[model samples]
Target: MTKVNVIGAGLAGCEAAWALARYGIGVRLFEMKPKKFSPAHKYGGFAELVCSNSLKAARLESAAGLLKTEMEMLGSLTVPCAKANSVEAGGALAVDRERFSDSVTEKIRNCELIEVIEQEVTELPEGVTIIATGPLTSGALAEEIRKLCGEGLSFYDAAAPIVTYESLDMEKVFFASRYDRGDADYINCPMDKEEYLAFYRALIGAERVQLKDFETHPFSVYEGCMPIEELASRGEDTMRFGPMKPVGITDKRTGRRPYAVVQLRRENREATLFNLVGFQTNLKFGEQKRVFSMIPGLENAEFMRFGVMHRNTFINSPVLLNADFSMREHPDIYFAGQMTGVEGYMESAASGIIAGTAAARRLLGLEPIQLPKDTMTGALCAYISDPFNDGKFQPMGANMGILPDIGERIKDKKEKYGVYARRAVDSLQRELDRIGCNSNS
Candidate 1:
């Protein structure tokens, strides 16, 4: 059997290792915890979620939901682990972080083909390897990656803050997910019109931490979790539509949706920690306390983690790598996760799966699996490898946007999404069959 080395035991790394092992490839998985730690990592756990627990959505009609369905069809462990430790959050799939990581750790350990190496890798080996070290990769290793990718490497990236559950003013907040659907795992802080306006004003005016040479390097904020201050700058109502949207949540005190709402979610299995649902930030520490406290229920909120931004590193995948994530320059090496420019947990895992499978195939003298473009996984690969910057090539998440738009535009959003999803799955099945994979054979 051929040996494949995978760096980083985070979501992407773990998934990559599992996929390769499944293909009968021996995998050496590297995790830099206990031996070394990132600024955001607290636990010595593998695949620790430094951000939110929510894995986007589980609804088949929604883009994220559809992507997850594709992952399941590909035999994803992340999806099953998520289901086992999942906390209901309406249509979305949110997991208990500890349990989720533990589950990933357990699965990898139990796999006979995988060997878990709890050491930080400073350099890549000469043989077939997949780099999935994620965003918080150590400075030394990041530099090594930069050496490999030539000019396309980045460093600074920001993570959102998490709060201690005990710090929340529960009396002023209510436990409810959106639309009162699923488990009431989210804590909502309702704000009347006047209160929301005041909070908005303070947020926009709050001071931000300055970075050295801020002009040369550019940073892009994650869409799902925008910094509160950035949201405020967009417009007073931006929050109302984005994070603070009062659509599905009803304020029991008013018997109606509040003018705005701040959502806090349980971050761990202990329920002792909570995260600001969409409050990723770059505000000064003092500014965070001053501005965030303006919210109705966060008057005395104790923050466990403050949002900090860092530079994101990624190569121009379209120009650098094939669909399998192996570089055109060097077929021996492969890149996965954010470095490959595939954003979000599911997308990252998908990249790992493809890369790992391809590496195994190369080793086993089998052909690489080229996923059908109609599948979410295939669409993502196409997006990354499109090579058409078109004046802008920001990293993209798997969404219906990447899907070839339907010729007949349906008026109903839900029904339209259903049609796209059905077509996508059907196309995927055909491609799988072409690749000699049968659903039940």
Candidate 2:
């Protein structure tokens, strides 16, 4: 049997290994956990989610959901594991973090075709290999990756804080989606004009954690995950136009549009914990509690996790990788996960599925799978690998805007998204069948 090496045992690495094993290829799965750890990693398990547990929205019309559907069709291991361990967050798929990691770790360990190697991999191993070390990749291995990819790697990403559900004042917060488009999944903390101004003042005035001299780099915000405090400092109304925008939602109590709203998304299935949506921050812990409490419903919020910033490394894939995630310079070497610049959790796993399947097919002497661009996975692959974006490439998460616009101009957003979703599913299914890959398997 052909043997393939998979590095990092994170979400993308696990998916890559699982996909290879599914295709009857032997896998040497390497992990640096238990023996060594990244700054963000705590759980000694494969596929540990270091940040938010929620995998984003679960509806097909959403980009994250569409990418997940494609992963399932591609015989994904992480998506299934996540679904099995899911916690309730209204329309999104949030998992019990520990249990989710445990599930993936158990499956990988029990797979007969996989050999688990728990040690830090400082050097890239010989033979065909897949690197999925993710954004928090550290130490000597990250050095090796930097050498291979040149100067295209980055090292800073931020995550939002989580609060106990009991801490929120229900009277001040109401559950609702924008325009009631989906289920009432998000808890909205509505604010009047005066309240908005006061909260904004506090947020802008909060003390932020100072990075060490060596840690200081020109902070480039990934547009999608902009820190709340940073957004606030942009301008007085910058936040209102961004995450705290209150356009579609009407406060039930007043039956009027709130001047601003802070939305809390469920972080687990039990609905016991909720994270402030789009509230990623780098404020000092005490300052976070002091300033964040200024929001209407969170005056006494019991914070479970305070927002923190960390370095997230990624390669400039557009110049180095093929659409299938194989290195253009060395076809035998593949990269997956956030390291490949596919930003979201499921997007990383989806890339792993592609890279693993592609690697397996090459080892088996089969033709490469050319995914249709209409599919969410295909669009992401195209986005990351297109050399046109070489100089301007930033980490991209799954979003409908990345997909090709529908030929007909449909004014209704939901209907247009529905069409895009249906088209992607059909296209992906056809391609999978043509390649003799069983989506259900």
Best by TM-score: 2
> For residues 1-441, what per-residue lDDT tens digits would candidate 2 score against the true structure?
668999989889999999999988999999988999876788998888876899999999877888888889889999889999999899999999999999999999999999999888989999999999887676688889888878867565677887867668999899999999989999999999999999889988888887543334545557777889888888999999998999899998899999999999875444656788889898998999898998888998877567766566789888899999999998999999999978778988889999999999998888779899889899889889887667655576776766666778776667987999999999988887887778554
- lDDT scores in order: 0.79, 0.86
Q: What C-alpha lDDT does candidate 1 achieve relative to the native structure? A: 0.79
> Which runs of model 1 end up more than 4 angstroms from their true locations?
155-310, 438-441
Best by lDDT: 2
Q: For model 2, what is the C-alpha lDDT against the true structure?
A: 0.86
| Model 1 lDDT tens row, 1-441 | 667899988888888898888777899888878788876677777778876798987999887898888877776778889999999799899999999999998999899999988888988876889999886678789889888877666443555566655557778899988887999988999999989888888888888877544322545555654667777798779989988899999997878888889898765334655677778788987888888888777887766456766566677777788888898889989989988878788889888878887887788787667787767889888777766642223466776656665678576768988998999888877777777754232
State the lDDT at 424 in candidate 2.
98
lDDT of 1 at 189: 92
